[model samples]
Target: MLIFLSLYFLNDIFAFSGSQDLCGYCFDTLVNSFDKRNSILSPSFKNEQHPIFVTWKKKGQLRGCIGTFSPLPLHSGLQEYALISAKRDDRFRPISVSEVPDLDVTVSIMHSFEQASRWDDWKVGVHGIRVSLNDGTSIYSATYLPEVMSELGWNQEQAIESCLQKGGYRGKLNDRIKAQVQVTRYQTSISKMDYQEYIQWRKAKLTSIRGDL
Candidate 1:
């Protein structure tokens, strides 16, 4: 069975709809099916905004990460982006199907992109950041959580460097599209379950939860 994306990033994508009280378990089946994803792109609330970053991990080691600095079209919503981060990031090796069983996915929901008006607002942990320069290009990076700074032991320079390196920032500062950004980052995680097992589990859960009797 392909334990590919089952239960990955469920918590991060669904947290804002708290009153709905949706759990990650449920999200495994009930995806954020909105094709024109409002939250991940141009969010309805101030907290949700464009150019967000996503990172994935399995058994506490880095797996994958990908995001945008400028607002990507909502058509490329979280579902697609999450999958891209999983199988496509070049940082580490591609996540093998074997690593699926022990994996866990964590996601960071970043705040609105703000130009670096004041460098002080940029805290390594508390901020999910984007850094860019003059041409028409930009960078994007986010952590699994605000605590990642302490856990990773990174300072601002390291964080900035990371955003630059990992997020595909190319060329000199005076070149490309120049822009400095910061975000109030929030995060969430979901236990990675077997993809086939999750599918079966969901069929059972839905039948039991949304019972006809």
Candidate 2:
């Protein structure tokens, strides 16, 4: 039988309250390139999603931002990739020890990819995005916008332009061969910076609430 089913991720609608492990897991995933999404996901808490976008900010300015598109890669889901993206997106390097004290993190739980051929497909403050061409040879990613580019002093055009430039489109932006743009959306659990004692607290909480780890 051709069995089929519809699946959904409910991490965004209801998040784990009280304990800050999800925030910590997302932060750990952003800070360290270690795959710990599963171990970090608390079954008792009931949210089982990984690789959410982790954006770092200080005051009202952007510090660093990064995450994975798909749930990392099974054993090593978004946990490792997100951290790598934040620290090594090339736009900015990993947060340094000096800058650590003045940063915050936002974890955006991502959705699947969607292609936009019509201009109507675009929207502000919604839709995380990926533009690709040459059969996936070229690609550019942006998860949760307005914030990402706005922080970089970019308008909508500038953001898409940057993507186009980085996307390696041999022709101009208005080239006859239109782009194969893939858009993905995510829900973020943004928390204020809680560096001091956050990790230690998480370690204790995870073990206490859910002994699986």
Instruction: Write the residue-wise lDDT of candidate 2 on 164-202 in tens digits.
Output: 566555555453334344433333333344555455656
Write out the backbone clash pairs for model 2. 72-77, 72-78
Off by over 4 Å in 2: 1-7, 10-20, 26-47, 58-63, 73-82, 117-120, 135-146, 149-156, 175-213
lDDT for 1 in candidate 2 is: 8
Best by lDDT: 2
Mind sharing the TM-score for model 2?
0.59
Candidate 1: regions farther than 4 A off: 1-52, 69-76, 134-148, 165-204, 207-210
Alpha-carbon RMSD of each model:
10.8, 6.5
The TM-score values for the models, in the order shown, are: 0.52, 0.59
Candidate 1 lDDT tens digits, 118-174: 333566645544443323354454333345666789886665556555556544332
